[model samples]
Target: MKSVLLLSVLSAAAVSAQPKLTLKVHTGKGQTGYDVNSTMIAGEKDMLVIDPQFTLSEAHKLAAEILESKKNLALIYVTHPHPDHLFGLAVLHQAFPMAKIVALPATVNAAKTGWPARQKFWFPTYGNNIPGPDPVLPEELTEPYLTFEGERFPVTGPLQGADGPGNSFVSIPSLKAVVTGDIVFDHVYFGVPKDAARENWEKTIDQIAALHPAIVVPGHQGPGATDDMSAVTFMKRYIEDWDKNAAASHSAAEMKAKVLAQYPNLGMEYTLNDRVAAYFPPAAKGN
Candidate 1:
């Protein structure tokens, strides 16, 4: 009996000594840039950041949070190439120069090639709020997963997302949590651009649901969005509604009206207008 008790105590001590992973989320509220989420996965002595912010001010705030955590910033993972998700790389890189910033190869390529146009399009409105002329891109990640303190955070995708292709998510299997890029949106209008494939996006969401993640951190969220399966459910339902409404409506205006009626309280109505307009442009003059 004494031997058994000694072994049990030893096992408890071993479990207690193991470093546990915790998550800290920094969400950019609506006025700042659509409430993009930046998640920090912290271990005992080190942490990994997923998806930096859109504006410089927000990024600086995120950096301050990281500093206060008292954990070494070891790795930074960008889930996609979108400006809102990765434009803050410069701020983070400056703050933690020794940390490695990485993303899937396709994402790296897209950011490299798309930076010039993205800058031009957003600069006029965002002005100096965004990153400067010299963009800081992430390195290509060759490995299938990210590692910190002996644990693996699996990287999935280049999967079909609302923003089109070259999107990815990082999954923490032990925690049953996923840091989804624009693949998921909480209480915001989905970015269904002209090139976006609704069917493919639905399938991708289905795949994510299959993982049974307890915590679902969306790339964009609203004021009081929670990190859970609700985002996944919301995206799936929203897409279904979009498909149904789009098919019945004759014009983008009609479609937008129908969707709004369904989700009147949803934020980012501009995104809905922009996407529908791309789908149904005005008739050529004098035709």
Candidate 2:
């Protein structure tokens, strides 16, 4: 009996001493107007993926990375309902049939409503570059933590951020990392919806900064932009600058010129004009 007790203790100790998980961040192409991000969280026996990506081609590439990991995909978490974030779910479903996809109830509703409109809008620009506007809506997360095999890993939020309402982020306590869906952008143009709530988004940025994560994985950015907290800083600065410029500028052209001057290297210039128009419509007939 003593020998058996000793062996049990030894086994438990071995399990406790195992190394913690390390996360991997994958960035899709920037030219798509939505530089989507996908994060993989690995454990000893399985892995979890966050926010697959935009196009079918991108999802295929993301799946290939997971397959190469040789770890069972335990679950997939869709952070938000934006078409770029949720539209590639069909591809992931084909790749990881066994993995359960989870999201907040709000995200599901938003995805359903936005899917059709986005399909029409993107078709002309993306052509056949994207897969089904048909997204695999996620099963609502019934519990506070995600379970892999029998072990539990805690995930926080339906946390709203930069992309507005229904945006969420995933925090892996073990990895000291947070996968921030559109709450943050690194040197990328933030989508300014026609009815953007600037104050709410700024508040969300504060909430994210409060989390004090050692590493931040933004929803849209290039590869070099991941694994750093600078995205948070840049996003805050961008919003502040935008608000300032929008208030002072007379037209979309003026706002665009001022913003581009401030952030010369920021990509998605085409969208910048749209954002300006959203906030400050063209001055009517040279008033």
Candidate 3:
């Protein structure tokens, strides 16, 4: 009789410790031509968010979702300093003041440094739709992990990329998942800048692949989290193809044509053309 009671108590405890995670994805079209993803992870008692959406309207929608969850907003993790990733944080902060907003130290610094310039650049395009409220500077993520209801949420990397430092991922081991920011891309064409460190980005991908996350929440692209390798594989192919062809091309149009011919189905041709023009500009006349 005592043994049976003990077993029941232990089983209940185990179930409580391993609460199921309810994931909600808020997707928005970035003005820069790619999609942005903001993932919300709700547990039994509290909820955590990863990389809130890109605009005020998108952030409000995400905030609404959090309000509907009816759980304590525990934390908001900004994966990197990119405007699309950090711009919506202020909105989330206003809605959930108790929720801790944080990121890797370097990421926080980058966000602070670039916020003003980015606002200037994007405001004209987004106009009244851009971030108007004062920006909220996120606190530094001092620890390497987070805990909610006694479950572990480990963070990894200042993953270096062509875009420079400040890339990171949050691993929910129990769920066998990871929220990868810009380190991995989905079906969209990746933003490859001039002097991008292609080799380094490849190494970062290998590092993420090592985690063997069953579900990936990529920063851009579609379908939200999925148990597949399509995102990683597609990103690898895109980068390699770009690297191989970039040197051979002399003009942005030529590069765009070459890449589009190879990957006609890849969305965001405008982004590709913009990157090519910005990185591989045409030589000035009479040079």
Candidate 4:
């Protein structure tokens, strides 16, 4: 009996010794190929959690770290409108009711309505392009309270090619970090700028670049961003490549196949709802 009690005490101590920020990152599970982090903002008692991990349990797990460490849950911020990025919102809210949800006004509006349009476009046309119903926020929050209007490129929408709401950015003044969501998919999605933004992709990047946050919190990676800010250049390069290939690959299937063949890792970007095989074609035609 005494041995069991001693073991319990040791386990409690081990849990107690782990840092709160470290605990926020559950390396064991709930990661959908993304590294989640809840930063230690300078002035806020409650943390400025970025992305909030990948699952309901993961959100619960993040909340558990706060509750255990006695930290206030100030707000949960989503960089953009992507499933793997924001699936934890409902769970986080369940744990931290008072915590406000923050995002660019456009992100909120787009997430509320834009994703569904993409769903409609892709489902019947392609059948298995994406995996789930368009992601909807908890019905309780109607209007986005916080707004970030990037002056570098103002958001005027034709929403041309991509169904994403609009490229938008926000500043966590306390953290000095700009939450850059799907607008910036690191170096990986750089080749497919149109895949993310149809209308104002460039403008959004300019806005974000103008702020030049000391640190940037992208949707799927860790902090300390030294590169990948050359999104505009990379995107332009991608468009040039696409145009060069357009003479031969005109159909959507051809475009899809070429994209997959060129970047095999991109086929790895699918969520549970996305189609793995379709994303990667039998071969890059004219091989």
Question: What TM-scores do the predictions have?
Answer: 0.86, 0.83, 0.84, 0.53
Off by over 4 Å in 1: 1-19, 193-196, 248-251, 284-287
Residue ranges of candidate 2 with Cα displaced over 4 Å: 1-18, 149-159, 192-196, 223-226, 282-287
Q: Write the per-residue lDDT of candidate 3 for residues 70-141, one digit (tens) a residue.
A: 889998999899988898887888889999888889888888888888988989877656676456778988
lDDT of 4 at 270: 39
Clashing pairs for predicted structure model 2, backbone only: 162-183
Q: Per-residue lDDT for 120-219 in model 1, tens only? A: 8888978888877677999999998998889888898989877777788889987789988988888888766333476777778888888999999988
State the local distance difference test value for candidate 4. 0.48
Better of 1 and 3 by lDDT: 1
Worst 10 residues of 3 by lDDT: 221-230
Model 4, range 165-275, lDDT digits (tens) per residue?
A: 543444544334565555554334332334434446666666667876655544443222333455444445656665555446645466556655664453223331232
Ranking by TM-score: 1, 3, 2, 4
Residue-level lDDT tens digits of model 2 in 95-119: 8899899887778777778777888
What lDDT score goes with residue 184 in model 2?
A: 77
TM-score, cand. 1 vs. native: 0.86
